[model samples]
Target: MSAQAVDGLSRRGLLKFSVGATAFLATAGVTASLSGCSSSDTAPGFDALRTSDLPFLLAVIPVMLDGALTGIPSQSATERTLHGLDSGLSHLSPEMLKLTRQLFDVLGMAITRGPLTGIWSPWENAEPGQIRHFLGRWENSSLELLRQGHSSLLQLVLMAWYSQPQSWAGCGYPGPPKI
Candidate 1:
């Protein structure tokens, strides 16, 4: 019953498309699984993310949390952020965890990652400009799934960063007042 329209698709239509797209992507993931593309050795310090997915999230954190990360040593900031993200992810519901893993898998695959995210190079080799373009495309995409992916990534990075005491100073938020 919503009146809003995005790119001429009604809100209901968009929701339907999003559901259908997710189903299709889920199916694609299953198909890709048969090719042995879903398995990756665990990263050294991460619990929820595979070794291959870490670089993509690393590439994303700086871009998504730019102002907050400024002046911090890149290596230290990245490690802290990754640790925070891993901690937060440990609490996700099973369904959410599955969807997140699927997203990571899509980003880790060369053929799909380039076309879907527009960052063709390995994350370490990717320029900030390329990462920004990829973010912009997802945030502004007509497809609801892409927009949701953008929102999910942005929220995850911001939540993980802002939850840290060190990040509070940048955002002008002091710690909770004593009782």
Candidate 2:
């Protein structure tokens, strides 16, 4: 929900296009499934998600804790990256989690139609290596928490995947070919 993302959304007709697209897709899906007319062709990615996708994503949050033992490390250069991602994802507000669930459902449906876009790649314009360094450590912290099991980390991880950009785009965006 950064201003930049909002800004990107507002440019030209993309904002309206995005919303309209989701409605079209969602309705088309319900229609096809109801008609029993091979909804499979209409919705492709959803079958793979299942409910487990939520739990798996949730698990990663706690795992991050185990990865970086020092909470807010003072000496390491990675401190900022770790802290930022941790802070970004760790706080799963109830409202956000609800939205994330809807997002997950939407992405799952989108995947059925095609590969997701604008979701996985971080939007910070950082080098792929840098984003990975940050997200990877965040994942590690989640992993540590996962080692403990049955923690809020699991729920948060689920929320993370649910809140993924790819998931949101699935509700609307037409993506590049998977090759």
Instruction: Return the top candidate by TM-score.
Output: 1
User: Model 2 over residues 1-179: C-alpha lDDT tens digits?
Assistant: 99988788676466576566657645544554455432222122232223323332332333343343333332231323233333443355756543433433333343432322223432323344443344444345323321222234345444443344333343453555579
TM-score of 1: 0.81
Deviation in Å, model 1, residue 119 alpha carbon:
1.9
Write model 1 residue lDDT over 1-179, tens digit each, in one string. Answer: 34454545776787787788778666666655557777645677778767767878888787777667656776677678888888888789967877777787777777777878787877888888899999999999888788888899888877887778777777778888989
Model 1 local distance difference test score? 0.77
lDDT of 1 at 94: 68
lDDT of model 2, residue 92: 55
Q: What is the TM-score of each candidate against the true structure?
A: 0.81, 0.26
